[model samples]
Target: MNDPDFPRRIRDAGGRVTAARVAVLRCLAATEEPLTPDEVLERLAQTAGPVPDRVTIYRAIEWLAAHGLVRQLATVGRAARYEAVEDRETHAHFQCRGCGQTRCLPAPPPPLPPLPIGYVAERVELVIHGLCAACRAGERR
Candidate 1:
C-alpha cells in the first residue's frame, strides 16, 4: 500500500524523501504486525523491483522510528520490532511465550498517574507475555 501521506509525514518530520525511505514506509504500511530489521530486509529482497541493502533498510527503520512515524517495541529476551503508526492508536503488545506469536493489545488505561517531577513521558509501551489462545488450547490436549 503506497501511502501518499508517508511522504508528507517524512517531510513534516524533517526527513529527506528518498526511494529507500518510501519503500520502507510502504513495507511497514502494508503490515499490521511488527517487523524485525531482518524481516524487513528479507521482504524488500523478496520483491521483484530493486531492493535496498540491509544497511539502507536498517537506517530507514531508525529514521522512521525517530521521527514518530513508526513505533518500536522491545521485549525481554526478544529482538526489537517495529510497526508503522498509521491509523493506529497507542497500545501495548502481547507475545505468546509458548508459540512466539506476537500481537497488538489495547492501550493501557489513560490518565495514568503523573510521573515524577522533571520526568517527561514521551511514550508508553507495555508488553504482556503469556500463552496465546491456540497455545493454551493445545496445552490442554
Candidate 2:
C-alpha cells in the first residue's frame, strides 16, 4: 500500500525518511501477515521501480523495528518477520505449522496475569499454531 503518511510517520517516530524505509513500511502495511526481509525485497521487486538490495531491506526493517514503527514477531529459529504497527486494538495471530504462514486474528488479547510489584508488561503476544484451512485441505487430499 502506498500510504502517503508513511514519510510523516517515520519523521514522527524520530527516523529519517528514506525510500527503502518507506518502501519496507509500505510493503508491510499492505500485507495482512508479517514479512521477512527477503519477502519484503521480493514484493518490492514486483513493484514498478528499482528495488533496494538485500542489505538495504534488512537495515530498513531493523530501523523501523527499532523506531517502534514496526513490530518484529517471534519466529524461533526461522527468519525474523515484521509487521507495521497500526493504531488499533491489540490482537492475536494464527500461524500455520505446515506452511509457516502467519495471519492476524481478530481475537482480543487475553488479560495479563497478575505480576509482582516491580513487574511491567510491555506487550502481549498470543500465537495459535496449527494448520490453516488450505494446509488442512491439502492433508485430506
lDDT by residue (tens digit), candidate 2, 61-141:
999999998998865446888899999765788888888888888777888789999999887788788899999999999
Model 1: per-residue Cα lDDT over 55-107, one tens digit each: 88889999999988888886655567888887656787888888666787765
What are the RMSD figures for all models against the true structure? Answer: 2.6, 1.7
Candidate 2: segments with Cα more than 4 A from true spot: none
Window of ten residues with lowest summed lDDT in model 1: 104-113
Best by lDDT: 2
Instruction: Score every model by TM-score.
Output: 0.79, 0.90
| Alpha-carbon shift of residue 66 in model 1 (angstroms) | 1.2
